[model samples]
Target chain A: MPAPRPDGACRDEELLAAVILRLIAGLRHVAVGAQSPIPATAALLARHLGKGQPFVSLLSSARHNFFTDGGRELFDCAGQGRVDAFFLSGGQIDGAANINLVAIGDYAAPQVRFPGSFGSAYLYYVVPRVILFRLEHSRRTLVNKVDFISAPGTSPPGVYRPGGPVALVTNRCVFAFDRQRGRFRLESLHPGHTLEEVLDHTGFDFDRPERVPQTPSPSPEHLDLMRGVVAPLLAEVYPQFAATVFGFTRQEQS
Target chain B: MSAIFRSLDEALAGIGDGAMLVVPPEYGGVAMEATRALIRRGLRDLHLVTLPASSLQADLLIGAGAVATIETSAVSLGEFGPAPRFAAAVTSGKIRIKDATCPAIHAALQAAEKGVPFMPLRGLVGSDLVARRPDWRVIDNPFAARDPIVLLPAIRPDVALFHAPMADRNGNVWIGRRRELATMAHAAAKTVVTVERIHDGDLLATEASAAGVLPALYVEAVAAAPRGAWPLPLAGEYPRDEAHCAEYARLAATEEGFRRYLDRYVYARAAA
Candidate 1:
C-alpha cells in the first residue's frame, strides 16, 4: 500500500464529505435536499465506494432524481419508510440536537429569520438516520438552546418515531447524539482543530473522553473517485460547487 | 363548453384582492406573467400558497406588496442565495408566514383535493411545528392500538393559478409529469391557467398525451400567454434566466435596491 499523504492535500469539503460517508454507513437509500452540496457529495461518494450499494438521490439534480410527483413525492416516500438516511442543517443547533430553521427572535417580529422550515420537521421524524451537519461550529450556530424548535431532536415516549438524529458533523468536531439520554457526546475532532478551540467556540456543553482522536482523512483512492467521478455527477446539479471544489472546467461540466 | 379566455388579465380577473391562491413550483409551472399582471393591477392583501415550495415568484410578489400572508414549505432563490425580499419581509414582520414542512403542505392540499375535512400524517408528533400550528392537531389513531398521529386541516384555496407549456383547444393543459398542478386545480375553488401556446387538437385523444393533460374540468379559465414563466424555467420548454435571477437577488438585497428592482423589472414589465 502507498504511504498516507499529508492531510493538507485534501480539501476541507472533501474531508467533511468523507466524514459524512462514514456516518451514513450501511444505509440503503440516502436522499439529499437542495442547497446541500457537502451531503450530496458524501451520498455520491457512498455510491462510489460500493460498500452497501446505497441508492443516492439528490433532489435538485434532474438526472439523479426519480420522483414524478414533484416535491411531494420525496415527503411521501419518507412517510412510507422508503428512505433510510437523510441530511439536515439548521441556523441553530442545541446540545439536545434540536434544530432551529425558523426565526431567531420573537415569532411575530424576528430579528433574524432563516428560511422557514422546509421538510426538516417531517423528514426528521421518518428517516431512520438523520445526520445533522453544520460546517460552521461556533457559539452562535451551536447554541445552548435554539430560539425556535423547527424539529425537536427527541420525541415523547409514546410517539411512534422511527427516525431521529444519529450524529452531527461540523468543521471542528463530530458529535454522536444519544437519543435516550438526550445529549451529545463528542466523537472526534477534525484534523488541525484543537479541543480547546471547540470548547471556547461552542455555546452548548457535551461529553468527551480524556483523549480525543483525530478524524481520519479520506483515502487517496476515495479522493480520486470524489474528484474525478463523483465531481462530474454532482456537477449535473451543483455546478458551482463542483467547479469551485474540484476545479471542473466549464467545458467539461457542459 | 370551452374554458378559453381572450386575455390574460381577464383570465386572472376572478382572483381578486385577499384571495387565497395555490400555485406550483418555480420550475414546474409558476404563473410569473400573471404575478406581474397582479402587480400591475395593484392587487394587495392576497394569501399565496405554494403547493410545497417557491422560488422568485413568491419573493417578487411579497416584494411588490401583493401578498399579505404566505403559506408554504419554503421560499428560496436557489443557487442565487436566500431570497432577499422574503428574508427582509419576514424579519420585519411585513407579511404573515405560516411555516410548514413540504409533506404537511402537500398532505393538507391533498385533503382539500379529495374533499376531505382533514388528513392524518406520521412524523409531526414530536415536532414543534405541531405544537405551534393550531390548525394541526395530534390525535390518537382510531384503528391502531395506542398510536398517535398528526391531522392537518385541508387547505382549500380560492384560486389555483399556474403557467403551462401548452393547452389544447379543449382547455386541457399539458403539464407532462408535474402532477402537483393538477392537485392544486382540484383543491382550489377556481383554476386559471396561462399557456405558451394552444395546441390545435384535443390533448386527451391519444394515449401518450392523455397522461400529460390536466383535463378541462379542473381548469376554469385558460389564456394564451407566450413565455409566461420567464426568468424561471418551465420544465422541458425553457431554461431559467440565471443572469436575470442573479441580478434580481443582488438588487433585492437592500430596501432601496429592492425598490429599484421593482421599478426596473416589475413596474417596467407591467408598463410594457
Candidate 2:
C-alpha cells in the first residue's frame, strides 16, 4: 500500500471520511448504501479503530454484507432498530432538514428528475443517527425549500418517528440538526473554509455560534488507518473512489 | 408436480400487454434476457413494479416504450450514473410513476403474501410519497393513542418474473439467500422464471437446498437461458459486466443512441 501523504495533509475525501468516523463512533452497526464511498470509507475506518465493534454493512459489496434474507432485510433490520447509523443525500436539502430526492419542479411536470427515494423515507425515521451527507455545498443543493419532500427532517408530535437527522455534513462545514427547532446549527467549518464562504453558498438560514471552531484534521493514526487498513477494503466496493483517493487499485491488491 | 418447461417465448406468453408485472432489484436475480424478449415482443402499457429499486432492466424497458407505469423506490445505475431513460421519461411525463420507499414495497408485497388488505408500517408520515399515493393511508395506530402510521395497500401483481441460477424439473428454484424472490412469487397471480440451467436432481431433495427453494406451486412456467442475467450480476455466478453497463449508460443517454443500442444488443441477438 502507498504511504500516507508526505505533507501530512489529508485529501478532501479522507477528511470527510474521518468526520463520518467521528459522527458514527460507538454505534453498534453502520450501514453504507450504494454510491457512497466516503461514508463507506468512514464505516470501515470506524470498524478498524473500534476493533470491529460496529458491524459495517455495504449494500453494494457481497463480501461486506451480512444479510442473508436479501435486499428487504436491510430495511427490515432498520425497522427493528438493528441498524444504528446510515447515510442519506439529496439533490436539495432545506433548513428544516427536508430532503428532495424525487424532482425539482411540480410532481406532474418536473424540471429535473432525481432518482426516487430509496428507503430514505423510512430509514430516516427509524435509524436513530441518520447522517445527512452532501458533497456539494451550493445554493442549488442547499435550498430554502425543497421542491418535494422525499423525507422530512422532523415529524409531528404524533408521528412515530424515532429516527431523524442528527447532522448535515457538507464539503464546506458540518451543521448539526436541531430536531426541536427544526433547523440546522452550523457546528464547525472545515479547514481552508470560512463561515462567510459557507453563508455565501448556503441558501437556507442556519444558526451559528459566535466562535466557530475549524473542523479538525484527521490525526496521523486516523490517516494511517484510513490509508493502510480501510482503503483496500473500500476498493472491493468502490474501486474508482479507492483509486482516485488513496491511489490504491484492486489489481495491485490482487 | 412437474413444471411446464417451455421455450422462453412460450414461458413468457402469459404476460400479455397491459399486465402489472412485479420484478426484482438489480441485485436480486434480474432477468435481463427476458427483459430483452419482452421488448422484442413489443408488449406495451406494462405497469412495472420493482421490488424496491432497479437499474438497467427498468431503464431499457422504459426506453423501449414498453412501460406505461413504473412503481419503484428508485432507478439508478449506481456507479454508472443516473438511469437516463427513466429520468427522461419521468421528466417528459411519458409514464405514470408510483414513487415508493423500499420498505413500503416490501411490506405491501408481504401483505399480499399473507392475503392481507394492507400492512401498517412505521415512518413516511411527513414524506410526500404518502401524500402523492392516495392508496397509501395514514391512520392513527389502533394499538396506541396519538400514534400515527402509514398503511400500504397490498400490491397483488398480475405476474412476477425474474432470472434464477437454477431450477429443477419440479420447478423448484434455488434462490440461495434472495428470499425476496419467494415473497414476489407468493404475491403475484402467476410467476414466470428463466434459469441459467435446469438441475437434474430435485431442488427439494435435500434439506440444505430446500431451504432456499421457491416451490413450483407458485411458478406457472420455467425456461432455461444460460447467462440470462447478462450485463447484471447473478450473485454467485458472475460479476456485473461493468464495461458493458458503462457502454450502455453512454449509448442510452440519447434517443438516437438508445436506438443504436437496441439495434446492436437487443434486435440483433436472436431469441433462443
Candidate 3:
C-alpha cells in the first residue's frame, strides 16, 4: 500500500494549500469575496500559478470585490454576465443555496452577523457558477434553508437562469444543487469523510453517489509545490495565514 | 469613444487639482481608468478617506502624498508592491488613518449618497480600528433597543471616479461582473465613470438588459476611453499592458526606484 500521508510529513498549512491546488488545477478564474476562503485559496493558487489576473490581482480594490483574477485573467461577475467558476466559504450556507453572513437571526442584534454579506448579495445575482467550500460543516452552520439568501442560488432559475451556485466542496464530500429547485445532492466524498459523516452535517436529504469515490488526494508534485512554492511565499506574503492554517509545528505534533 | 468626452483633456479630466477622491477598493481597480489611466494623470493632494489599502493604488496614493487618512474597511489589496506604509505611519502618528471596514466605508459613502451628516453602523466592537481612530465616536445603538453601534460621520467626496466596461452618452454605466463598487460609488458624491468604449447601441441594442448598467441618476460625467483599466482588464476589452506593467513592477520594488520612475513619468511629463 502507498505510504499514508502524515501530519509530520506535511505541515497543517498543506490542508488549505492542497485544497487550493486541487481547486485551481484546471480552473482559469475564481471570484473571491471579502474574508471568503475561495479567494484566499485562489490568491495562494495565483501566486503558485503566476501573476496578472485582473480583478483577482487587485483584490483590495472595490472593482475586484467580486469575480476571479487568477494571474492576469479577470473574470466578470455573473450579473454583468461574465464568470466561469468561483468559490464561497467561511459562512453558513443552506439547502436553497441561500447563505447568511449577517446575524443568524435579525439583521440587528443577533447571535452573530459574522460579517455582512461580503459579496454574497450581488455575487449571488451576477456570478454564474459559485462553488461553496466549507471547512467546517455542522448542523448548526448548515441548514435546510439559509436564513437569508445573502446571494440567491438560482434566482428563480426561470427556465434559463443558466447560472447559480454550482458545487459545494466541504471537508467531507462534494455536493451540487438542482438548477431549478436549488435542492442539494451529494456529488463526491473526500478521502476521510463517509456517507454518515456527510449525513450528519447536511440538514436536507441528499442524493449521494451510489458507489462514492474517494476525494482526490493531493499529488506529491502538488504537495511539493504546496510546501515549497506556496508555503514559503505564504510565510513571506501572509505569515499569519501560514501560522494559522498550517499550525502543525513541533508544538502541534507534540 | 463614449462621445461624452469630445476631447482627450475631458477624457482625463476626473481629478482637477485638489479633489477629495476616494480610491474605493482595488478589486481590480474597476473604477480606475482602463490601463489605470489615473496613473497617467499624476494628480497631487488627493483627499483619500478609504480602507486599509493593500495594493498598487494604495502605493500610488501614498507615493503621490494624496492620502489624507483612511477610514478603511481593509488594507488587504492582494499581495503586490510594497507593504502598505500607511499602517506604520498611523501607528507612529505620522499619518491619520481612521480604521474602518467595507461596511464603514459603505456607510460613509451612503451618507454622501444621501447628503446626510452621519450614518450609524453595527460592527466595530472591540476592534483595533476603533481604538486607532480617535475621532470616531462609538456610542449606544441609537437604532437598536440596547446594544451599542458605531457612528461613522458622513464623508461626501467632491468627485468619484470609476472604470466601467461600457457607457452611453447620457452617462448610463454598465459593469461586467458585480456592481458592488458601482453601488459604493453611487452612494458617494458626483460619480465619474471611465469606460472602455461608448457603445453606440449597435450590438448593445440586442443587449437591452445591459442598456442601463448604471443609471444616469448617479453618474455626473462619463469618459469612454478604451483600455481604461490599463493594468486591469475589462471583460471584452484589452487586458493589462504587461510590458508597461513589468516596468512598473521593476521600478516600484523600492522607494528610490518608485520615486525615480514617478519622477520620470509623472513629475517630468507635466503634460502626461
lDDT leader? 2
What C-alpha RMSD does candidate 1 show over the true interface residues after superposing them?
2.2
> Which regions of candidate 3 deviate over 4 angstroms?
A1-13, A17-254, B1-3, B6-8, B11-14, B28-42, B51-54, B75-77, B84-95, B142-145, B202-212, B235-250, B263-272
What does candidate 1's lDDT look like per residue over B21-137, in tens digits? Answer: 998877578888888888889999989998788989999899989899999778888778888889888888899888888888888989999999999888777666776788889
User: For residues B1-272, what per-residue lDDT tens digits would candidate 3 score against the true structure?
Assistant: 33455443464475665667665444333554321345556555556655223345555556556555544444433323222344333434443444345555655666766777787654343333455456567676544564555577877776766676766666666764445445456656676777666766533344664533656666667765555555544444544343454566667655677777667755564323
lDDT tens per residue, model 3, A171-231: 6677777765557778667666788888887875667657877656656765655545544
lDDT of each model, Cα atoms only? 0.86, 0.91, 0.53
Model 2: residues with Cα > 4 Å off, grouped in runs: A1-4, A251-254, B1-3, B270-272
Cα lDDT tens digits for candidate 2, B37-84:
989999899999999899999999999999999999999998788999
**lDDT value, residue A25 of candidate 2:** 88
**Measured by TM-score, how close is model 3 to the native structure?**
0.52
Candidate 2 docks with a DockQ of 0.68
Which residue pairs show backbone clashes in model 1? none
Better of 2 and 3 by DockQ: 2
Q: Each prediction's interface RMSD? A: 2.2, 2.0, 14.1
Worst 10 contiguous positions by lDDT, candidate 2 chain B: B263-272
Give one digit per residue, the lDDT tens place, for model 1 in A120-150: 9889988999999998899999999998899
CAPRI grade, predicted model 3: incorrect
lDDT of 2 by residue, A163-204 (tens): 999999999999999999999999999999999999999999
